[model samples]
Target: MSPYYVSYKSDGTLVSGPGSITAIGNQTGASSYNNRTSGYLWCPTARDFTVGSGGNKGTTADLATRTASICYMRGLKERVEIQTSSGAPWQWRRICFRFRGNIYGASGQNSQSGNYQTHIETSNGYRRLLLQFTDTSPAGNQVENALTALIFRGLPGTDDWYDYMNAPLDPTRIDVCYDKTSTISSGNTSGKVFRKNFWMPMNKNLVYDDDEAGGTESSTYYSMHGKQGMGDYYVIDFFKAGLGTTSSDVLVFEPQSTLYWHEK
Candidate 1:
């Protein structure tokens, strides 16, 4: 179970489902797709990143009985939020995940016997998975990534946490940061790497625009896909008092880690 990325079209088409981990960058954006402003886009919604040994998710395993990760989340909050140098915040549909002691399933893309679905919100202006992972050790960043959790507010404290095996009516959000390296020439030598925040950073550069498609491990991604694709990865943290301002705004109903979201 090697951890990999997934993609989808703006219309929510299943372009990269289970077993397509190695084919992420091989599609070679078609000329017709290049000119079009919207169509298929790369998303960062990582499923089955952690699975119980009971068996493939959604089949033999009982998600509620297992612990996908651990984090405290109240429905009243922003799904995803990013702070900046000016202290402005960027928000989106989000869910939270705890990376500490997390047993990442390499075949994270597989555990599922079929298409899995996590955050399914139908009660808001929009829908998304606001994932939150808290690591106080260190921030490991890469030169190239599909997305980067910039620290515009403040650094994480010693204690923080993400997702539970079973998400409730409302999900939580996680914030990941990776801009703390002495030299860009060298590699990020921090705890973020151990947390598995950033993916392969050696040969590929991450782009948010699907049109910027090209790379090896991760290529171009577009948020315009409308919360489609595997659900784009987001950088968020809006609840620490010492760092800056925080909130508990609700976006949509939180998603659960059921067969719909776990196995393939």
Candidate 2:
């Protein structure tokens, strides 16, 4: 019997399937893939929803709102396994996620600018990866306080967020890969979509080796095996709290928004 399954609610209806590569990637082609190391997450466009204004400035909406869109990936606790140098077995807990989405003003404006963020919760809601907008000073004296902050946090048996910025690896320094604006036809109007893409740097310090008894603890290791949990299925929340008052001025999650990851 198959051991893995993924489930999520779409338009108040529950949908589920085996956690196989074909299923997870929503592939419509072959029965299987030769490369099982990577696949696309099965986030349906029907599951796509919007967040209104008046949310917390730098965070998502309340837990009740987040829980409504929660997705579950069972049998992921041990999807990837490895062995330490001491012959002890270990599950390499790393899977990188690539998020592709768009930002646009919900109002009928031809242009849009806003503070947007993507929040990913995993480990049964104990761990979080927050991809905030980056506030940078650009040319022409432009300021971007509207930009969000990228951060990682965990719940160490408490209700508070345990910051991971001070860690030696510095996982909080996430960078964007692509961002551009283009015009597209939306029904009868020529609408625009601001496409933004993000992928974590592979140079992160997620792997540690204590092979030498007295060697200095080093943190310069990189590998696909060291990627974090995209396999566990993530409850991803997109929030837009722009500095505007128009109810039409909102962030839109495009139907093409996707999560790509490598598995063991």
Candidate 3:
């Protein structure tokens, strides 16, 4: 049994399965035009997301900054056609990453914090996906910023799972961890501390750890097999919120895929 499950509807009653609904386009709200054309939607507001800045330290108030990171795990079975506004069709899949952790920067010395962030390739082939993290202080002199560890496939539209595999030593358990520490001080005053940890799962059997230096690393192969199953269609797992510490939070994105017309 998969540790994660995909559910539709607000009640979490419409559990998805192998031979479930495959078509997209449906009414998501009472308003006629409010119909949802996306194949699926999963919003994980229940989980707290955070991003780390760097290491832990302080004095001049410019210690380390706070940044947000994302971790994603996906199980795919088939391939779906990704269409663009120019009427271009390409093969693609949706990989969702669920995040849970603290948003605000850690306090005091020797403190740590972390969050999870996920990404996927749109039909258009644009690789960079911009995500927002929380603001430090509205009226403070502290320097703050956000960071994330991105894992992806280098060879786009390829079908080899081994290249993208992060084979975990243990076949039964797979774990990913990211930690950041911040230190701040003037020209020899004192130092403060800030730190954070973020983690998620890559299937046990499909685990592959390339152990590259930077976070913006991409795998050369696919982690899971691409067979004819439920994985071939559009899939929505959960929705993640930004790291804004206040109500002025906003999640922005430019739609990359062209909308398709489905005959109900």
- Candidate closest to the true structure, highest TM-score: 2
- Whole-model lDDT, model 2: 0.21
TM-score against truth, every candidate? 0.19, 0.21, 0.18
Q: Please provide, for model 3 over 1-264, each residue's C-alpha lDDT reduced to its tens digit, 9 standing for 90 to 100.
A: 213322211221122221122122221111112211112322221111111122232112221110111213333222221111211111112233322222122331111111122222222211212221212221231211211112232221235222111211221211223212211122122221212221222232322222244864433112222321111111131112211111121111122221111111
Candidate 2 off by > 4 Å? 1-118, 122-176, 185-258
Q: What is the C-alpha lDDT of each candidate?
A: 0.21, 0.21, 0.21
Question: Candidate 2 vs candidate 3: which has greater lDDT?
Answer: 2
Q: Score candidate 2 by TM-score against the native.
A: 0.21
lDDT of 1 by residue, 1-264 (tens): 112222211212223221111101122111111111001111123222123222332223433221222111111212211222222121222222322111123322321222222222222211233222221212331211111122122222313312111112112222222222210111221111111122211121111223322652222212222332222332222211111222221111121111112222
lDDT of 2 by residue, 1-264 (tens): 111122221210111122111111122111111111111112111111122233321113322122122222222121111111121111111222322222112331211122222222222321112222222121221111111121133332245432111212213433232222222122322323333333322222212211233653312111112243221122232221212112222122222223221212
Q: What value does the lDDT take at residue 68 in candidate 2?
A: 20
